[model samples]
Target: MTAGVLDEAIKKAAIAWISVGDGPAYALWCMPAESSILVVSGPGEQFAPGLAEAERATVRLRGDHGGLILVVDATVSRLTPGSDEWNELAPPLATKRLNASGTADELAARWAETGCAIVRLTPAAGSAVGAPDLPAESAAQPPRETPARVETRRPFRLHRVRKR
Candidate 1:
C-alpha cells in the first residue's frame, strides 16, 4: 500500500521538498523514472546542496490540492555523464526543464563540462509515510535574508494649478 501511494505521488509531483542530512529542505523540480526520481542540479540549475555527496535524503511530496501527501527516505545516487542511464534520462529531463537556455544536447554538454550532477533518488524500502503520520504544524519559516529590498519613495499626488 505504501509503495503504491509513494509511486503515485512521485509520478504526479512536479516538485518535491528534499532535505539533505541536517539541512533545511529545498524545493526542487524532479522527474519520476520507473522506481526512482531524477533531479539535475549544479550551475544553471536548481540548488540542492550536498545532494551529490549525501548517501541519503528526505523527500517530501505534496498532493495536487497543495497538502503534504507523502514523506519518504531516499537513497541518493549520481548518474555519470554519457552512461546508459544518463543517456536515457537526460533527454527526457531536458525536455521537461522549463526556461532552458539551450537545446538538450547543448545543455548536456554544458552539464558535463561544468560538472552538473544528475542524481537519482530511490525510496528506501518501507520508509514511506502519509496522512495521519504527517506533522500537524504548517512548517513555514521566515524568508531567507537577501540583498534585494524595496526602495522607499514618496507618493505622487495630483494637484490642480490656478490659472495665471
Candidate 2:
C-alpha cells in the first residue's frame, strides 16, 4: 500500500527535503515517529526557512542509491517547548544528532532556550507517491552560491623532468 511505502521511506531516511509553497527545498535532518517526522530548525540547527510559519509542506525522501524514492504532502506543526510532545521527542532527537557537544538532555534544553523550532511533519492521507509514480524529471538544480571555493594553483613537482 502507498501508506506502507511512505512509512518505510520515512523510517529509513535521515534527511528529507522540505519545501514550503513555491520555495526552495531545504534538506533537513529528521527523526521518524509514529506516522510523522520530527525536524529541528532555527538557531544552532539546520535552517528550515518558512517551516515554522507554514501549515503544510512537501517532503521528499531519497533511496539508498540517492534517487528520489518517495514524495508526500505533510502537515507541519511547530511543537511547543516543554509540552508533553516536546518532552517525548526532543531527547531522542538530540541523541540521534551527530557530533553534538553535550548530553541529550542538555542539548534539548539548549534547543528550547535558544529559540529552535521543532516542527512535526505528519503525512496527509492519500498524498504519498512511491517510486513507480515518481516523475521522470530528476529535478536537479544548480548548487547554492557560497563564498567558499577551491583555490587554484600550479601543481608542485618534486623535481624537474629531463626532456628526451
Candidate 3:
C-alpha cells in the first residue's frame, strides 16, 4: 500500500465517498488525520446510518472520469462526543467547514447536543487500491426527461377589429 501517497490524497481531498455493504454511496465530508479518515453524520451533513455499527467500510477518493483514485478498506468505529478521541478529532473536522462554528469547542458542544456520531475509518493494510477507470452509472438509472410546455395566452387583433 502506498501509505504516504494515500495519506497525502486524503489530506488534499476535502470529501470522500463511502459505502457500506451493498448500500448506495454517500458523499461524506471528511478530514484525514493520523492515518484515519474522520467523518461526522448528523442533522445537516450527509446521512450515513448504520455506519458506526458496521464492521468494515469502503472509502474512496475519486478522480476524473468516475475513476477510483484511492480506495481504502477501512474498519469503522464510532467516537462518542466528549471522549478523548472525540476531543482530538471532531474539532478539526468542524473547523474544516466554513459555517460549522466560530470555535471547535462550540462545535464540539453542538455535536454533543445533537447526538451526532463521529465515525473513524482506519484504512486496512494493503488496501490502498487503485482503479484505472469506471463507467458512468447514468445508464443503469437514466434521468427522466420532462416535456416542455408552451405558454397559453389570449389572441388579440391589431385593432380589435375596429371595436367590432
Candidate 4:
C-alpha cells in the first residue's frame, strides 16, 4: 500500500482505538508497554513488507518474554496489495481499535481486507518489565527531502538617490 494510504489507515485506526486526534497523516510506530502499547504516528516514506505481511495475515507474536498481538485495520484512500505503497508501509504493527472486542482472528481478517495488517510485540522473556519505550527508530532517520523555504521579499525596492 502507498505510504499515504497506510498512514490514513493508521490514523483512522488510532482514532478508533485510541482517543487521539487526527493531526496529520504519517507513518505509525509502537512499542510494548506495561499495560497498553505505546504508539506514535509520524510522517515517513513507508513500512517494511515482512512486518506488513505478517500483520496482514493471522500470526502469533512470540519473544523472549511475552508479547501481545492486537488486530488492527488500516486503510488509506488508495492501497493495493503488492503495490509500491504496500512495500513502503511494511512491517506494520498489529494494533486494535480501542474498545474493540471479539476474537483476534476476526478482527485481523476484517482489517486485512481493508489493506491493513496486524502487529505483534514480544517482550523480553523472563525479565521483570515496566513500561515499554516508544519506538523512535524512524524519528532518527533523516527526511528524504527538505521542504522548501518561503521567502518574503519587500513589495518595492528603493534606489539610492545620492549615488545617481
List, in order, the clash count of every candidate structure.
0, 0, 0, 21
Q: What's the lDDT for all of these models? A: 0.89, 0.91, 0.75, 0.32
**Backbone clash tally (model 3):** 0
Give the Cα error of residue 109 in candidate 3, in Å: 0.7
lDDT of 4 by residue, 1-164 (tens): 22332233323332222211222223344433322233322122123334433222211122333332222232112234455543433323323333435454444444445555433322222322222432323323344444575667857757745765
RMSD in angstroms, all models?
4.5, 2.4, 7.5, 15.6
Per-residue lDDT tens digits for candidate 1, residues 20-137, read 9889899999999988899999998898999988999999999989889898999999999999988888888988898888898788788888999999999999898898898898
As for candidate 3, its clashing pairs are none
Give me the runs in candidate 3 sitting further than 4 Å from their true place. Answer: 63-67, 132-164
Candidate 1 clash pair list:
none
Error of 3 at 73 (Å): 0.9
Q: Which digits, one per residue and each the tens of the lDDT, describe model 2 over residues 44-139?
A: 899888999999999999888888988899999999999999999999999999999989999999999999999999999998888778899878
List TM-score per model, in order: 0.89, 0.90, 0.73, 0.25
Residue 100 local lDDT, model 2: 91
The positional error of residue 82 in candidate 2, measured at the CA in angstroms, is 0.7
Q: Which candidate has the highest lDDT of all?
A: 2
- Give the better candidate number (2 or 3) by lDDT: 2
